[model samples]
Target chain A: MNQQETGAGEIKISARDVQVHYGDNHALVDVSVDISDKMVTAFIGPSGCGKSTFLRCLNRMNDTIDGCRVEGDIRLDGEDIYAPEVDPVHLRARVGMVFQKPNPFPKSIYDNVAYGPRIHGLAKNRSELDEIVEKSLRRGAIWDEVKDRLDAPGTSLSGGQQQRLCIARAIATSPEVLLMDEPCSALDPIATAQIEELIDELRRQFCVIMVTHSMQQAARVSQRTAFFHLGQLVEYGETGQIFTNPSDPRTESYITGRIG
Target chain B: MLWLTFLIIVAAAALAYVLNLRAARRLWAEGARLHSITTFHALYALFLAALPAFVFVVLWLALSGPVIGALVLSGLPDEVRAGATAAQENLLLSEIRSLARGQAFGEPEPWKAAAAARLTALEATEGWARLALVSLIAAAGLIYARTRVSASFRARQRVERIINGLMVFCSLVAIFTTIGIVASLFVESMRFFARVPFFEFLFGTNWEPQIPIREDQVAGAGAFGWLPVLLGTMVITVVALVVALPIGLFSAIYLNEFASPRLRAVAKPVLEILAGVPTVVYGFFAVLVVAPALRQAGQALGVDVSPNTALAAGGTMGIMLIPFISSFTDDALSAVPRSLRDGSLALGATRGETVAKVLFPAAIPGIVGGVLLAVSRAIGETMIVVMAAGLIARMTINPLDSVTTVTVQIVTLLIGDTAFDNPKTLAAFALGMMLFLVTLGVNIVALRVVRKYRELYD
Candidate 1:
C-alpha cells in the first residue's frame, strides 16, 4: 500500500498543519495526517520526538498543560475542534484517550466502567448503567475474567487487566475515536502482545490512533503508520510499506532499528 | 577552653589526613614512593603531636590557675586568710600579680603587699611545673602513636567508623528527647491522677475550680467534672469541620483537576495565605468580627444571643484550618494516577465526572487523613476559643449559647498564682493528658489509614 491509497481510506479525523508548542519548545511542527474510520493509525518515533504530543493534539489534551499552544486545524469528521465555540469537555467525550500506564480509578470495577456512561447520561438508571458496564467490560476483552469481582477496586487488577479495564472505561461511552499514548509500554511482553491484539480487534468499531515507541507494534496492529522525528512527521504510508520499504533513509534506518 | 582545644585538634587532624592521602596517591601513582611507613602514619604523627599539645595546655591552664592561688592564700596569716575563699583568693592573686608588675591595687595593706610578692613567685614556679607536665604527657602520647603506626595500617577505615558512630549518636539524640518528653508528661499526669479519681475526671460533667480564700469559708468544694469542657471541644470541632471540609475538598478538587497552571499559581498562594496568618490573628478576627456578627444573627433569628458563642469561634477556626485540608487533599488527589482520570475522560466522561467518580474516591484515604489532622488541630486549639468563646463551662448543646473548651479551661486554671498541691492547678494537668491522648490517637489512626491506602494503591 502506498501513501495515496492509504489517504483515500474513510476519514475519521483530519489534521492540516497541526503545530504544538510548549513554552519555548516546538513540540509538534507543522504535521498533517488523516486518521481513518474503523482503522488503526500508529505514530512511531524516538523518545521526545513528539509522537505523544501529536496524539494529545487529537483530543485537545495538550490544553491541560501550561504554555501549550496548538495552531492550524484539527477536525473530527469535518467538525472543527479549534473553533471558538467548541467546548473541549464535550469534544473529549467523542474523542477519548487511554494513557501509557494503567490508571484505574480507586473505584470498583463496575463504577469505573459506569462512570463515563453515568456522567454523559448515556444510561437512564442504575440497571441501564449496569448493562453498559458489562457490555464495555466484555468489549474490552476482560469481562469474563472480572465478571464476579465487579465490586472490587479497579486498581486491584494486574497490569494487563488494568490496561484492559482502562480500555473498557474508555469505550464505555462508545467514543468515535480512541487515542492511546503508549498504552502497552509499561506492560510486560505478554501484556503488550495482548493489548496489540485488542487494538487490532478494536479497529472493527472505533478509529484507533496509537502513539508507540515499538515499530513492531505499529507494523503488527496499525493499517497506517506515521514516522516522526525532531517533532516533524517524516513519512506516513501503509504499515507494510513503512516497515518493508520506505521513500526516506531516515524511515528505513528507524524501521531497521539502526537509529531511533 | 577544653572544648575549643578539642575542636581545633579535630579540625587539624582532618586537614592532615586529606593532604596525606592526596600526597600518597600522587607518589604511588608516580611509581617511586619512598617511605618506610604508610602515608596515613605521617598524618597520624602530625595529629598526635598537635592534638595532645593543645589539649595538655588547656588542661594545665584549667587546673594550675586555681591551685597556685590557693597555696598563696594558705601561707597567709589566719586572720587574713579568714576571707580567703576560692573566689577571693583568685581575685587577690590577680590583684597582687598586677601590683608586682608595677600596677596599683588602690591602697595595698602591708600583709597583702607581702603576700602578693610571695604569690607572684609561687605562680611562676607553678606555671613552669604545669608546662613541664603538659609537654611530658604530649611527648608520651606522640611516642605511643608513632609506635602504633605501620605500613599496612587502615587509618581511613578506622576514622570512617568513628564518624559513622558520631552520626548515629546525633540521630539518637532526637529520639531520646521525644522519650524524655513522654516520660515527663507521664509523671506529671500521674501526680494529678493521685488526687482526683481517674474515671470521674475522664467522664466528668462539670468544671469549676474556685478555691476558698478565707479560713471561715469551706476549704475544698470545687466541682472538677470535665464532660462540659469535652463537649464544648467536640461541638467546636464539629462546627469547624462543617465549615472546612466542603470548601477545602472542593478547592482541592478545583486546583488538582480543573485549574490551569496560571490559575493554580495565582490561587494556591492566595489560599495558603490563610495559613501564613497567625492563629492569634484568627482569634482576634473571631472575637472582633465573627462573634459580633453571630450575636446579631442570633438575635435576628429570634434566638437568645450570646456574645461569645462557640459558633463564631469554631467557624473562624475552621476557616483558619482550610489551607491544611485543602493542601492535603490537593496532594492526595494529585497523587491519584493520571491514568485513572485519563481513562475516565477517554470513556467520554467530563472532567467533573472523572474527578467526582474516580479521583475523589481514590483519594478518600488521604483526604480523610487530612481531615483527621485538621480535626486534631481544632480540638487542641486554644487561641480562637480563648478570644471568642466564653469562660463558662455550661453543659448545654445550643449553638447560640456560650461554651468553654478544654484548652481554654486549662489556660484559665493555671494562668495566675496557684499552689501546685491544689486540685485547681492539678486539674489542668489531667485535662492536658486527656487532650494529648485524644490527639495522639487521631494521628495514629490517620497514619494507619494513609498506610493502608498506600499499600492498596501500590
Candidate 2:
C-alpha cells in the first residue's frame, strides 16, 4: 500500500503550520497534514514526541489544559476549529475523543453511553435515546457483555469493557471525527485486537485519527501513518510503505524498533 | 518516695539497654549469628526492666489509698465508728487523712489524732514495702531479659509484640474514656429522672430549671420541660444550614472547578480563618454587631425584631461554620477523579454542567456528609447562642423571635456552685445525654454516607 492507492477519500481535517507549547516547553513544532474522511490515520512516535499533543489539537482537547497554547490553523470540514467565534463545547460535540486510559464517567453503563447524546440533545424521546445507546454500544463492540447490566456503574466493568463504553459514549453524539489518544495502550493484547477490529469497522462512517506508541498497531489498524520525532513530523505516508519502504531514516529506525 | 522509685526504674532501664546491647554485640563478635539485631535486644531489655516496675508502682499507688483507709478505719475509736452513717464515716476518714498530713482543719478529736498517727506508720511501712517489691521485680525482669538475649533469642518479635500490645492499650483507653463519659451522663440523668418524670422533660413545652436551694425560699420550684430548648436548637440549626449549605457548596465548586491555583491558595485559607476564630469571639461579634444590625434593619423595614433573636445567633454560627463545610466539600469535590471531569468535558459538557451533573453526583455522598457534620456542630454550639440568642425558652419558629438552645440551658444550669443532688444541675446531664445522642446519630450517618461514596471512585 502507498499514498496514491489510499488517496481516494476526501480530505476531512486539514492542519497547516500547527505548533503547540506548554508554558516554557515548545512541545509540537510546525506540522502540516491532511486527514481524509472514512480513513484511519495513525500518529506513531516515541514518548513525549508530540504525537498525543497533535491528536489533542484535532478536537481542541488541549483547550482544557492550563498553560497549553496552540498556534496556526486546524480546520474540520473546511471550518476553522480554533476560530475565536467557535465555541469549544459545540466543536467537541462534533469531534469526539477517547483517552489513553479508559475513562468512563462514574455513572451507570446506560448513562455513560447516553451522556454525550443527552448533553448534545440528539434524541427526541426516551426510546430514541435507548436506540442510540444500544446502537452505539453495539458499534463499540461490547454491547453483549454489558447488555444485561446496563444499570451497573460504568467503572464496575472490566478495563476493556470500560474502554469500549467510553468509545460508545463518544460516538453516541454522532460525531463527524473520532480522535483516539493511545486508545489501546492500557489494554491487553486480546482487548487491543478487539479495539483494532472495531476501529476498522468504524472507519466506514467517521474519520478516525489515532495516536499510538505501537508501530505494529499502526501497521495493523491505520491506513495512513505519520511519524513524529523531536516534536516534528519526520514522515507522512501509508502504513505499509512506512513499514516496508524507507522514506526517512528516522521513520525507518522507529519502525524497525532501533531508535524509538 | 514514688517519684524516687520512678526515677530509679528509668535509670535501671537505661543501664539494662546498654548492658544488653554490649552482650548482643559480644555474641555477634564471637562468630555466633544473632537472630535479632543488637538494637532490638537493647529495646526489649529496656522494656522488660521498665514495664514490670511501672506496673508494680501503679498497683501499689492504687491499692495503698483504700488499704490505708481500711487500716485507719480499724484503728479509730469504736465510739467514732459506732452509729455513724457511711457518709459520716467517710468524713471521719478524710479528717484522719488530713490530720495525718498535719493539715488539720479544726480542733482534732483525740481518736482522730491517734488514728492519724497509726495511718502515718502504716503508710510508711507500705511505702517501704512497695519500694522493695518494685526493685525486686525490676531486678527479676532484667535478669530474665538478659538470659533471653542469647544467639537464638527472637528479640525483634518479642519487642514487636510488646509494642503492638501498647498500641492496643492506648486505643482501649480512648474507647473506655468515651464509654465512661456516656456512663456518667446516664447515671446522672437517671438521678434527674427520679425527681422529675422523663416524659415531662421530653414532651413538656415549658422549660424553667429553677430549684430552691433553701427550704425558706418562696419561688424556686422550676419546670424542667425540654421541648422549648430542643425546638430552639432545631430552629437555629435549620437557619445555619440554610445560610451555610449554598454558600459553602458554591464556594467549594468554585474552588475546585473555576478558581486558578493562585486564587485558590489565597482564598481557601482566608475562608478557613473563619473557622479559626474562637466561638467566644464569634459570640461577641454576634451580640455586638450582627444583633444590633439586624435589629436596626428590622426597625427600618417596620418588622418587630427582638434584641436577641435566633436569626442573629444562627447567622453568625453559619458564618463560623462556612469554612468547615467549604473545606470538607472542597476535599470531596477535589477527590472526584480528574478523569470523570475530563470524560464529561470531552462529551461537550460545559464546566458548570460538568460540575452539576458529573462531579456533584459523584461527590454527593461526601457533600451530604459534610453538611451533616456542620449541622451537628451548629446544634452543639454554645457561646454564640448564649451571647446572641435569648435565654427565655420559647417554642417559636420565627427567626426574628428570641430563642434559647439546649446548650445554653445546660450552661446556665451548671453555672456556679449548685448542689448536684438537686434537679436543676442534674437536668443539665439529661440535656447533655440528649445532645450526645443526637450528634452521635448524625456523625454515624455522615460516616456511613462518606464510606459509601468513597468506594465509587476506587
Candidate 3:
C-alpha cells in the first residue's frame, strides 16, 4: 500500500503562520500544517520541541493556561476556530483530547466513558447513553476487559487500562477530530502496542492527531509525520519519506540521533 | 546573683567549644581523618560540658531557697514552732528572709533576728558550694570530651542521636499536656457524677444551676438536666452552619474555580483576614450591630425579635467562620489534580459542569471533613454567645429567640464565688466533659474521612 494514500480523507484542519507565546517566551514559531480527516498524523520531536504546544493549539486548549498567547489562522473545515464568536467549550466537543497521564474522573468506569456524552447531551435517553458508553469502550478496545465491571471505579484500573478509559471518555463525545498528547508514553510496551493498533484502526473514522516522543512509534502508527525542533516545524511529509529522505540537515541529524 | 551564675556557665561552654574546635583542627592537620567533621566534635564537646553543669545549676537554684528556709525554720524557738499552722510557718520564714535582706520594718523579734542570721550564713555557704560544684563538673565534662575526640569517635552520629531524642521529648510534651488536660477533666467529671446521678444529668430536660452559697439563703434543688443546654448548642450550631456553610463553600468554589488570578490573589487574603479578626471582636459586632439591626428588621416585618437573640450571635459567628470554611474548601478543591480538570475541559464540559460533576466528587471527602471540623468549632464557640445570647437556658430552636449554649452556661455556672465541690461548680466540669467528648468525636470522624477518601483521589 502507498502509505501517503492510505485512508487519507478531506482536510479537516488547516493552520498557517501559527505562533504561540508563553509570557515573554516565543514557544511555537510559525507552525503551519494541514490535518486530514481520516488519517493518523503524528508530531515527533525532542522534549520542549513545541510539538505538544502546537497540538494544544488545535482546540484552543492553550486558552486555559495563563500567559499563553496564540496568533495565527487556525481553522476547522475552513472555519476560523480562533474567531471571537467561537466558544472554546463548544470547539472542544468537536476536537477532543487525551492527555499523557490517565486522568479519569474519580467515578465508575461506566460514568467515565459516559462523561463526555452526558455533558454534551449527545444521548437523549438512558439506553442511548448506555449505547454510547458501550460503543466508546469498544472503540477504545478495552470493552471485553471492562464490560463485566463497568461499575468499578475508573482509578482502580491499571495505568494502561486507565489511559484506554481516558481515550474512551474523549471519544464518547463523538468528536470529528481527536488530539492525543503522548497518550502511551506512560504505558508498558505491550500496552503501547495495543494503543498503537487502536490508533491505526481509529484513523478510518476521524482525524487522529498525536504528539509522540518515540520516533519508532511514529514510524509504526502514523501515515504522515511532522518533525519539530526548537519551536519550528523542520520537515513534514509522508512518514516513510521523512524517515528515509528528510530534506533538511537538522531533520536528518535529529533522525540520525546526532542532535535533538 | 542567679543571672551572674548563668552567665558564667554560658561563658564556660563557649570557651569549651572554642578549645575543642582548635584542638580538632590541630588533630586534622596532624593527618587524622576524623570520623566526623570538626564542627560536630566542637558542638559535641560544648553540649556535653555545658548541659550537665547548666542542669546542676538550675536544680541547685530551685532547691537552695527551700533547703535554707527549712534549716532556719527548724532552728526556730520552740514557742514559735508549737501550735503554728503551715501558713504561720510560711509567715515566719518570710519575715526572716525580709530581715536578712534588710527590707523588714521596725525591730525584729529576737527569734526572727536569730533566724535571719542563720539564713544568711546558710545562703552564703550554699552559693559558694553551687559555684564550686558547677565549675568542677563543667571542667570534668570538658576534659572527658577532649580525651574522647579521636579518629574513631562518631561525633556527628552522637550529636544527631541527641538531637533526635530532644525532638521526641518536645513532641511528647504536647502529647503529655493533652493527656493531662483530659485526665483532669475526667477526674473532675467523675467527682460530679458521684454527687449527681449520671442518667439524670444525661437525660434531664431542665438546666437551672443556681445553688445559693450562703446557708441561710433559699434556692431550688438545682435542676442539672443538661438537655436544654445541649439543645441550645445545637440550635446555635445549626444557625451558624446554615449561615456559614453555603456562603463559605460557594465563595471557595468561586475563588478556586472561577475567579481570575489577579482577583483571587487580592480577594483570598482579604477573606482570610476575616478569620484573623478576634472572636471577641465578632462578639462585639453581634452585641452592638447585628442585634439592633435584627430587631429593626423584625419590627419592619411585623415579627417579634429579642434584644439578645441567637440569630445575632450565630450569624456573627458565621461571618467569623466564613474564611475558615472557605480556606479549607479552597485547599481541598485545589488539591484535585490539574490533569483531571484539563481532561474534563477537553471533553467539552463547561467549567461549571466540570466542577459540578468531576471536581466536586473528587473534593467531596475534603469538603465534608472541613465542614464537620467547622461544625465542631461552632458547637464550642463561646464569646459570641456570651456577649449576645441570653443567660437563661431556653430550649427553643428559633434563631430569633433568646437562648444560652453549653459554653455560656458553663461560663455562668463557674463565675464568681462558688465552691468546687458544690453541684453548681461541679456541673461546669461535667458540661465541659461533654463538650470535649463531642468535639473530639467530630474531629476524629473528620480526620478519618479525609484520610480514607484521599487515597482514592490522590
10 residues in a row with least lDDT, candidate 2 chain B: B212-221
Stronger candidate by DockQ (1 vs 3): 3
Question: Could you tell me how far off, in angstroms, the CA of residue B204 lies in candidate 1 after the best superposition?
Answer: 2.7
Ranking by DockQ: 3, 2, 1
Off by over 4 Å in 1: A1-8, B1-164, B213-220
Candidate 1 per-residue lDDT, tens place, B200-253, comes to: 787777777776534566655888889999899988998899999999998988
Best to worst by lDDT, what's the order?
3, 2, 1
Q: Model 2, B96-136: lDDT tens per residue? A: 88888999878877877889899999988988888888888
- Model 2 residue runs over 4 Å out of place are A1-8, B96-128, B453-458
lDDT of 3 by residue, B1-458 (tens): 56766776788788888888888898899999989989998988888888899889978888888888888988988888999998999988888888999997988888888888899899889878888888888888888888888877899998898688779989999999999999999999999999899999999988888977679869877888999889888888888988999999999999999999999999999999998898889999999999999999999999999999889988988898798899889998999899999999998888999899999989988898889989999999898898988988877888899989999999988888789888889999999999999999999999899888877765
Can you tell me the DockQ of model 2?
Answer: 0.66
Please give, for every candidate in the order listed, the TM-score of chain B alone compared with the true chain B: 0.73, 0.93, 0.92
Q: How badly does each model clash, as a count of residue pairs?
A: 2, 0, 0
lDDT of each: 0.81, 0.90, 0.90
